[model samples]
Target: MFGKTINEISLNDTAYFEKTLTQSDVFLYAGISGDNNPAHINEVYAKESIFKERVVHGLLTAGLISAVLGTQLPGPGTVYLSQDLKFLKPVRFNDTIKAEVIVVEIDYDKNRIRLNTICTNQNKEIVLTGTALVMPPRKRMDI
Candidate 1:
């Protein structure tokens, strides 16, 4: 059920992915991305900062948006063209975040799509907002 082609897509087509952030999630992201900022990994250092608590990496939270696009809406073969994001709030450990995507426009001639991307926490606070441009998978030709 992956790889929905441009012809099969439409305005307002949507998808979502949800996950609860964990300490291990933060640590692993830090390790893999080499973004071991004190605000994200050191509770003591974080306590001294404005947020007053360890916060998840902004990009880590934003990845949920990628999750939705790659695995749900256009799925599998979708090629991400670009994304513009704004981080609105801090996400602490244990926050359940849901990333959502909505097709705001489509360019049939170019096979490109513009999508409204957003992420909200369990408390329904918008943590991130963005727009993404993607090329949905091409139609498969019969063998």
Candidate 2:
């Protein structure tokens, strides 16, 4: 199925999705991704690092952005073209991260849109910020 088609979308449109990171989520991600860095699983090892404790993988946290884009903003049929991200803070277990996407530019002829992506923690601090280029569904798809 598709979300809002290009014709229905407008600049400044926004969407949000959030998740509370847990040990299980991190472990599953680590298992699937094979990123067994000690900082993500070994508490003792991470305690010695700057974070002072285990931290969730940055990419894992960033996935929330994908969730928003693929399910809420441009939705189901949206095709992500590119993204530029900056990790501003460490995401620890049990932190609730809210991901948001806002339309900033649109090319009707090209069927492309530029969105500002941002992730914030429960404390309202920005953990990640980025921009993405995507092509929303050309027409609604109902299956």
Candidate 3:
């Protein structure tokens, strides 16, 4: 009786978020998170590394997943409980990423949703995959 009402949730509910990765995005993330890894910030070092080019911070890309959860699907009132992520590919500057989430399971009693999350580049290559556990709002509010 305390979480999202059973009637308000359903399987297969989906949400999406998109952004074009930029140099500023990487730099700002580094400044804010204090993760100035060379592979993400140094052109010379990155060119020598396996990727052979600068790569975006993994967590910055993952933040798109958070945007989807916080702004869509279960939306504004949902409480993020946990997540499991697997990075499949590198994200580079200028790559347009589309992040998506689909509801796969609903716990009626607990008012929780288990969502399958994924992010793909403009080329449709999967770059990130994960599952998120969240608690939706207890009651609907009129907009």
Best by lDDT: 2
What are the Cα lDDT values of the candidates? 0.93, 0.94, 0.89
The TM-scores, one per candidate, come to 0.96, 0.97, 0.93
Residue-pair clashes per candidate: 0, 0, 1
Model 1 agreement with the true structure over 26-134: per-residue lDDT tens digits: 9999999999899999989999999999999999999999999888878888899999999999999999999999999999999999999999999999999999999
| Tens digits of per-residue lDDT for model 2, 1-143 | 55778998999999999999999999999999999999999999999999999999999998999999898889988999999999999999999999999999999999999999999999999999999999989888553
Candidate 1: the clashing residue pairs are: none
For model 1, the local distance difference test gives 0.93
**Per-residue lDDT value at 64 in model 3:** 95
Query: How do the residues 1-143 of candidate 3 rate in per-residue lDDT, one tens digit apiece?
Result: 12334467689878799999999999999999999899999999999999999999999999999988877767777789998999999999999999999999998888788999999999999999999999887776333
* Least accurate 10 contiguous residues by lDDT in model 3: 1-10
Query: TM-score of predicted model 1?
Result: 0.96
Off by over 4 Å in 1: 140-143
Of 1 and 2, which scores higher on lDDT? 2
Q: For candidate 1, give the lDDT of residue 97.
A: 100
Native-vs-model 2 lDDT?
Answer: 0.94
